[model samples]
Target chain A: MLDRIRIVLIGTSHPGNIGAAARAMKTMGLSQLAVVAPRCDPRDGEAFARSSGAEDILEAMQQFETLEAAVTDCTLVVGASARSRTLPWPLCSPRELSASLPGELSGSDTGLALVFGREDVGLSNSELQRCHRHVHIPTSEHYSSLNLAAAVQVLAYECRQAWLTTTPVTSPEPFGVEWDNPLASHADTERLFEHLERTLINIGFHDPDNPRQLMARLRRLLLRSRMDSMELNILRGILTRIERHGDPNGNDHPR
Target chain B: MLDRIRIVLIGTSHPGNIGAAARAMKTMGLSQLAVVAPRCDPRDGEAFARSSGAEDILEAMQQFETLEAAVTDCTLVVGASARSRTLPWPLCSPRELSASLPGELSGSDTGLALVFGREDVGLSNSELQRCHRHVHIPTSEHYSSLNLAAAVQVLAYECRQAWLTTTPVTSPEPFGVEWDNPLASHADTERLFEHLERTLINIGFHDPDNPRQLMARLRRLLLRSRMDSMELNILRGILTRIERHGDPNGNDHPR
Candidate 1:
């Protein structure tokens, strides 16, 4: 389960921070690292220098062009951000986020991605929308400038602490008792959002030209529900049926 | 209470670590930082650069020649160490340490010193002996080389989390139901240890030549009890009486 927990850094400016983040992750027993369109070259010598003995994690790190690509396979995607966001999103402390992991990642195939944003500017609104939940580390009101690697270190430490104390269930318990379906991956959730959006637009219920946080609200609602694979299929099937019913030249191909 | 939590680094070789540590402390609302026998100049350019915006903390940092001098005023002294020691000591996780802080720092005069040792080699046996309790951050078994600043970040983060969640008590409450005396400071505890050791030697109960682990065991016992000032005075008076009774050339000085 620790191996399944990935630390993803997006648009990181400093290679040293990348290296230090790797070191931090390794110290917490998290080996999977992914980078999404980093501003600095993560393979720079400074990265290895800062990595100390965690060069193995750096060497084995996975790089992607976008956050969606980075966390497409992850079942749970959490973004680390400051508390000054104007957008109302699901916010939780690192401790709360970690406490939910035992149940969240109970399935063998269920993986989690802890996403960190750029040093100067945090996750953009679109990038944040992709995350299932946002984690805010409570810093001082006087000084809230937490360094990039330091943020990673704090969250990774929480995850490790939670992992150490939790006893792993030998049999996979799917959140609720006797539920057999695997949790929906990021890709699965994203596809559902797209289908829902298109169906809404076709039915004239949502106007894409003058979108007023409608999709964002729906995304929040669905993400909070944490739909399993079977639930996702049912929702997508409903979306397809709606599209067929609303569209003038639509053929019903829903399974 | 946060300001009273002093982060003490002993024999830190890297100025960058000192700067990063200051940044970490500031993020967690901790302002007091003390360094004992640092190998590198904490005011070096690297430290300031690493501090980012927390230079004020670095500028206001205190320096000391010894750990004793650093934490003499503190009521609680906790050392951060790895778990490979042959000697038995009271060990706790970062969470457990934070959980104890509410009651521990309830007094107006009570302060805590979180001691971190050298980067390469952690706290020495003598340094460990000075601490009332040792905190061990659970890290990966394969790579336990946690960066000094990262360690600071984790502990500081925990302290902040504890602070944020706990409601402050309007009035200070003693540990016991009706205990009126304040907790003993590190200086007071040190004096008690010295007096206890001398009395033991005088009474022929403990030999200085073959000291073994007698002092360490006694220190652990006294530290665990968390004696109040009045309790400390009573114990010291008892030791003085024992010395007078056991010593050949002792003068009677009754308190």
Candidate 2:
């Protein structure tokens, strides 16, 4: 699992940050680093000084011309971003992201790319949209500025923890604790959400005419819980049961 | 709750670390700083340079000869340490520490003091014992060395999160410089310092070329101490009286 994780830094402004980031990644046993259009030389003196003996990682760094180029080969691409956009994307806490990783990396040669943005503005719109998910590091609301390397260190630390432990059948069980089954995948979860939303509208529970933020909020809630295959099946069965009574043409005679 | 969080630096060898720590604390709305037997002058140019805009915190800093004295009034003293001693004290990860804070600071006249030790070796065994709890920020196991300022920033960030969510019951007025008055703004504080430096110089108490960093250090100390408007007026009044006594023509009373 460790070998499958890639750290991608995009449009990094400082050479020192690249060096520090390399050091941060290496400390957690992560060696794969891809730099996309960095503003400074990765092997500069400041970078070496900040690496504090982890210069080997910097020496082996791979350079890319664009964010798309960096994560093109990875199956799972995650953006480390704190910003929210007009259209909501799937978001994961570091723990949740960690818990999901072992399951994703279990059988495939496919890799996971953890992408960080420039020190200032973070990932561009298209870059963030390219990610499979976004991870937010909880910090103070007023003083939310975390150093770039520190952010990498935190996410890498979480990945290391998850790599050392078994993936819970449901998301976020106690560390080192295992379950009998694996959680449903993102694709499966989205299908379940669509099924649930359609059933809710059929039953007159959710009004499409004045649809506020119901489905989006449900997506947020269920995605955080991370249901297993059994949980998903049970939920879908209930939705199917309710579907028989609430179809547009099912009412024989209106009372 | 912000007022109740006190930051203590014990035997800190560099003045720059103190300034950086002050800046970190102020960004998260914490103001109290206590320095215990620091080896370097707290008023040095390095401190001012690193403090950024948080010199108010440095100005208000309290000096102590011993760790015990520094935390005498604190109901809960927590030490930020990376190394463990022969016997383990009650230890908390940073997340656990954040979860426990809201319960501790609410409805209490007492305060909590977070103590950080020397840059190289962490707190002495006795000093660690002085704390009610020990918090360790989870970092890379291989290269777990975090800068002093960064550690402080991480902890302060957590405290700020806790503060924003909790209900306000009481203000931490007793610990501040003056009761029943809010702290003077940075602009007001700067004016007060100007008033002070001019008076001290006019009284011939401060030499021009050999002035050393007395004024600069004093700015750091008083700013961090967070004196209120009333306290500012009282301090200026004292300086006014001292100037009258030190005037060159005041000693000609036929003696």
Candidate 3:
């Protein structure tokens, strides 16, 4: 998967970021490198100095005249940009981008390219539009600007983590005491809500005719609390018993 | 818990970062903010401008002369740093630090403090020592230097998640599935070894007169797996059944 992914740098002014990006890619087991009209020579002494023994990546770098040329053979193109644009293309965080890569590129001959923009001004709206997806690295709202290499490093690292930690079963059960079987179900919740509404009206805490807003808010709060089945059953049982004792009319409750 | 958590920024150079940190804290439902010898005025126009409606956090912020003064009442202090030091103090990742915090500060009068360092050099060795624990955010080796407020946001978010998700239980079960009973108990493990030793001697797997090396290796393997009670009982039951079927003395009749 790493070999199938190519990192494309567009109009990069700093040769050091080119080298750093190579180093970042190599550290995460990625080697394919593409540079599009770099302002400085990638093979320059400064670039090699910052490459930090990642000369193999620098040596194998491919130069292209345009972003489209670099991504010509690529099936899935992800543009790295912090700025949000008016375009309706899918926007992804770095974590989201990493997660989406493997399935998009698996067993396919087409290359997957992650395109980064210029240092001073990031990818223009038109340039970002050429790619299928845009990825943003979340930073502080005060100073969201991230150096090109730093952004590349974050993306590459997340990609490697996503690949290495792919498991047959990824999600863990909810963190708490797990019962062999739930003591209650969705039907129980509805029954409890109705009982609670009656109780609230009896206690004068709710207006009988227009009580939807308060009940909805209470339901949301309970849902967010993540009550286990047994707990829900206990609360519902209490409410049902209360309703039984305090009926104003001689009408039996609906099943 | 949020009120108890005092976010102390030491020698913060950027007013914008201070404001951003406040915003991060507020978003995570933390309110206590402390500034230690900030280089820029926290009330500056730029700071308020960048705060983006988190002006209340800045308005309520406390200014301190020193880091120690800021954290004097704190019972648990966590210092954030990307760099590892030669110090002998306990070091934890952000996850570990988050796990340890809830019990240490909650329900007690003790204050909890999260100290962030200077934007450029980060916390000096002396300043870092004042903290009871240190946290490192996992980042790419290529460029591990994270923006000050970005680091703050990550840590605050993690801390809030930890606090919100903690279930108040007298005894929480270990991670993994909820078993009917543990695979092995502490006492079962101790007894299993004794039974195994006697069986080994009867079968001549261990010398009755002199035995140490082989037994030591076997003990090491058993301890390494952290065998639980149920597993030990099953193994012992199997061993006993095997012994009854086969005897070293070659007895023809059942004893």
Candidate 4:
């Protein structure tokens, strides 16, 4: 799903930002980058310097003289906007754009282009009109403009996050992740609670007649803790120890 | 709510990255900036130049000697981690951290600190342990380390997105939530851990000599639970009772 989405930079002025943008995209697992009518050479020294370890992405970048040529193969073109209220095109947040990607580019061959405008002026009215939709990153009203590379980072991050939901990396296991022992079952938890309540009363820490939400609060905490079988056994062992210590007989038989 | 969130950079080596981070935060409506023992002067020319128009945030940046000092007042401290599977700390996604902000910072006095470590080395194990939770930004497994500014941009952007869409919940209080008590502060939680360690040792449930990841497992469980002050107090009371009852004299003492 991430591979189907290409990052398109339109009329990008700074060569360094282009490299930085590539680095940003690569960090989020994006490979395809397209430049439309860049003002400067995209492969300048500063571009390589800013590309960090992502020089391969910069080397493979596709360049075109016009937006039409750049995204001619794309089935969905969403222009990145600065949240302009006057635009007639349907505007979506970066999250919304990410959410719509799996469906919009459902086919393996279908390509989607996310077009970012120049740092100073952004996309021209004609360029904006050509997009299928506009995706806007919400920014502070006081300082609305975001650096080109930073904007790309946010969008690419969102796309990666959304894409992760579509694929099954590892089957979702019960919580208590990587525990050596199995997570305590519901019945085990209930039995532990009963034993805990009895021990608490035996130790005079809890009063049954006026419980006053003590057991309820303990239940809430322990349930949220999500203990595994080992941790549960440890707690139960501790409770038994306290019960024996408090008992006058110090025997197996309960009073 | 955004105002309560502070971005703390630890041992940052570059002035330019500092400036870029400020710009990233300000673009997302986050103004608070704190630095722990930065390697370079944060107010250098490169920092100011890279800050773009977010110079005010850079100008007002707070300097600290250590991570503890940087986040002393914050009730919640979340670290940006590179998704190391061996870590015992509770790990959350950026969106999960953002979604939790409203509920975690429900009180007016509550504050949150998002800590980013040294650009090259990332957070030390000790520094990572200080955080109540660790937030990992999903990136390509091949090139997981994000540029410090890019990581800040991604996290800050999610915070802004979550803030914009948040509506106060009119629904009844959810289970495990205590309305009256604020979430336990970092200091409070630390004290609880100290007390817990001592109590476990006193009860012979744990041995300090051969500590086999016992405390780490317990820490992971309790931190995931996210105890409020009242619940924390209740647990402390229970510990004190057990300690006293186990003593032969039933004296007012920890031992």
Candidate 5:
């Protein structure tokens, strides 16, 4: 899913940010890079210097004269902007953007583009309007601006998380006995509770009309225990025997 | 919960970083600041100049003779370091560190302390040992080093998020059903579950020999729904009547 997504740098001024962006994309298992009119040479000494070992992405980078040319093949375009734009076109949080990408690009041959603007000016209104969605990087209210590379890193991290979560992962097996299939049945357990309630009523342990806290506490205790079928049956048996012995009249206990 | 977070800087050399740390903390709604063995006076012009209106944090900062003195009152001590240590003592991711704070400090007067080291060299081995846990922020492998102020900002942001999550705020009253006062008690629900299991057995819905997935699914469903006392009673009442009618023979029903 990540491979199908192409990250486009639109009018990027800093060679270091372009390099860093490549590194970020590579870390998150994304490689397709399209540079739209980069001011600095992406393959220059400074660009590769900042790119670290992600020079491969810079080497394979495709240059485009215009943003439209860069994103023409793309089906879903995500524009990265620190500040909100005047025109709205499906504004999404980073989390939502990450989540929506996989489904939108699954099995589709069409490319998905993530466009990042220059550090100083950012994406113009016309530039932002070309994209399907706008993603904002949450920052401190005092200083909402983020370093260009840092923004790329945050977005890349989120994308990786989305990919990992969607993929299957093994988990440890659960402990404890199977509850659904024990010696006792649902019928037996219900009878046991009825008998217990009756016994409580008989012993003046409960006042049904204006019951206080005892029952609630008792319920919490039982829930915490996570009783299995066999165990419940055993308890029920005891209750039934006790009820039979205590009630000779066989009259149903009143609430 | 935000008030309970104590930010401690040990042997800090840069006065600017100290001021910046104060600003970061204030931005995240964290007020407590402690300085231990600072190379420069925290109240110096350089420190105050960079504080950026967070002078109150510097003014209220406590000076400690030793790291031990600073963390003496704290129950949960988190040490921040960029590099891994020789002997790892329960290393925690930033998110884990954030999540663990609330539970560790709940109802306790003891504050949660986050210890940061100098800008040049992080916490010493002995100083790191004083912390109950160590947390490392995820950074690029090429340049994992983060500016001291930047590190503080990231940590403070995470801490603020954790604190807000733990601290319950007033919410709008739930609409529709009185979930808090469900007709059934917890005890009643447990009984219903038991009875339902028995019914399932009789109906061949549950196989005794091999039953794990189904039971787990059922339990998960009930747990997610958050069954209440009143709801439990209503269900139990229905189950009791069904058991009595379905299996009239007392001997056949057993317990």
Candidate 6:
């Protein structure tokens, strides 16, 4: 899904930004780069310096005279806009774009274009109209101006996350991750809760008669935490110490 | 949550990157920064210039001689990495990191450290082991190198998003932040599972030959939610009760 996606930079004012954007794309598992009517040379010294060893991406980047020509093969063109216009486009957050990307990338020949405009001014009204959707990165109202490269990084990162969900990687396990250790089983968790209830009662910390919201809050806390085996052991060790010595700070002297 | 998160850069080579990182942090509403034995002076002209009007953060930055000194008050230390080392730490993507961050932050006094290593070598093995968790920003296998400022920006953005959750969030959750609680450390969670599988097999609930989907489902359930210390104690107590009684339904009776 990531491979089918193309990153388009339209009339970028600075070559350094192009390089930085390329670097950002590479860091987020993106390679296909296209430049439509770029103002500066992407292979210049500033670009090379800014790329930080992602010259390969800049070298292989496709250059076209027009945005339409660049995204001619793309079925879905998502323009990145910094502002809301008089006529609103299908604007959503970067995360929303990621969620809907898989469905759009389903077609074999379907290409998805993530078009970024010039550093000074974003996509033109006509340019944005040619696109299928628009994504706005939420920032503080005080300083909402995000750097072109930073914006690219955010969007690229989102695409990679979304791609991980859609396609299974050949190298790593599903979602490119599989835990080396197992999580605490449901049965064990239930037992831990009982042990906790007992320990609390013994230590005069909790009253079973008027349990109140203690157990519920604890359940919410533990259930949310998803304790692993070792954490359970550590907590159990502490609890056992408390039960034996009735000392809350008996954690330092372990058996 | 964002205020409690400290961005620690250890032995950074470039002063400019530090300034840029500070800029990124300021943009994302993060201020706490700790530099452990940096190669270049953060107060240098380059750092100030790179900060881009975020000199207040740079001016208020904390300096330390060692990683230990920097994170003395922190309970949960998470390292960011770009490479896969011989010793694989508890690795997760940035999105996952952001989701689990809020619960950990609920303990008002507990501090969480987001440690970034040297530009070239990253966090050392010992440094990583000292850390409770690790996060890897998913990058392209071909060119996975990430700029220090860019890396900081991504994490700061995530932390800002996570922080938004604990406080009354002004904006809707991007990617739907379903945080129940903070996750247990890898070591602790492992012990709970080992103890669980042993007890279940002992009590005739599981056969080692045909483990079935019981454990898998349990894992999904546990990992889906976060658990806290008291919750772990409660669950462990219940497990102990079952171990003693050799009865899956012996949860009601006290030991």
DockQ for all models, in order? 0.15, 0.03, 0.02, 0.51, 0.05, 0.19
lDDT (Cα, 0-100) at B70 in candidate 6: 88
* Highest TM-score scorer: 4
lDDT of 2 by residue, B47-164 (tens): 9777866788899999999998998888889999898778989998766787788888775677889999888887899899988899986666666766677678767867875775
The lDDT of each candidate is 0.81, 0.72, 0.67, 0.85, 0.66, 0.75
Which regions of candidate 2 fall more than 4 Å away from where they truly are?
A: A1-4, A26-31, A93-111, A157-255, B14-31, B41-63, B157-255
CA RMSD of all predictions: 26.8, 27.7, 21.4, 3.9, 15.5, 9.9
Give lDDT tens digits, candidate 6, residues A1-255: 888889999999888889999899988888899999989887788987898888888999999999999999999899998888999778888878889988988888999999998878889999999988888876655555577888899889889889888766555422234544456788888888888778777655578899887888777666655566655654565456446443324443232
Residues B1-255 of candidate 4 have per-residue lDDT tens digits of 899999999999999999999999999999999999999999999999999999999999999999878887788888998857464556778987787777666676689999999988999977887777788888898887589999999999988877897788442222324466677877778889899989888866789999886777777677767677899999899888888877767864323
Angstrom error at residue B124, model 3: 11
Shift of residue B49 alpha carbon in model 1, Å: 1.1
Note the clash tally of each candidate. 0, 18, 8, 0, 17, 32
Native contacts present in each candidate (fraction) = 0.42, 0.05, 0.00, 0.57, 0.01, 0.34
Residue-level lDDT of model 2, residues A124-238, one tens digit each, is 8667755656888765455545667767877777787677675443443422345334545545555687797786665445678886755654553344344555666655654
Report lDDT (Cα) of residue B54, candidate 3: 75
Q: Write the per-residue lDDT of candidate 6 for residues B1-255, one digit (tens) a residue.
A: 667889999999999999988888887888899999999897899999888778888999999998878887775778897777643345677887888676566654557789999999998866775565568987877777888889998988888777655664433222145334444544454456677667666644567899654555444344334344455555665456555443324444333
Q: What is the lDDT of residue A196 in candidate 6?
A: 79
Ranking by DockQ: 4, 6, 1, 5, 2, 3
Residue A88 lDDT in model 5?
A: 60
lDDT of 2: 0.72
Native contact fraction of candidate 4?
0.57
Error of 1 at A33 (Å): 0.2
> What would the per-residue lDDT of candidate 1 be over residues B51-145, giving only the tens digit for each residue?
98899999999999999999999999999998658988899899999899878888999999999999989899999999999999999999998
lDDT, candidate 5, A123-161, per-residue tens: 888888888889876555655445565566657656755
lDDT of 5: 0.66
Which candidate tops lDDT? 4
Q: What are the models' TM-scores?
A: 0.80, 0.59, 0.44, 0.87, 0.50, 0.68
**i-RMS values of the candidates, in order?**
29.3, 28.9, 22.5, 2.9, 14.5, 9.2
> Worst 10-residue stretch by lDDT in candidate 4 chain A?
A171-180
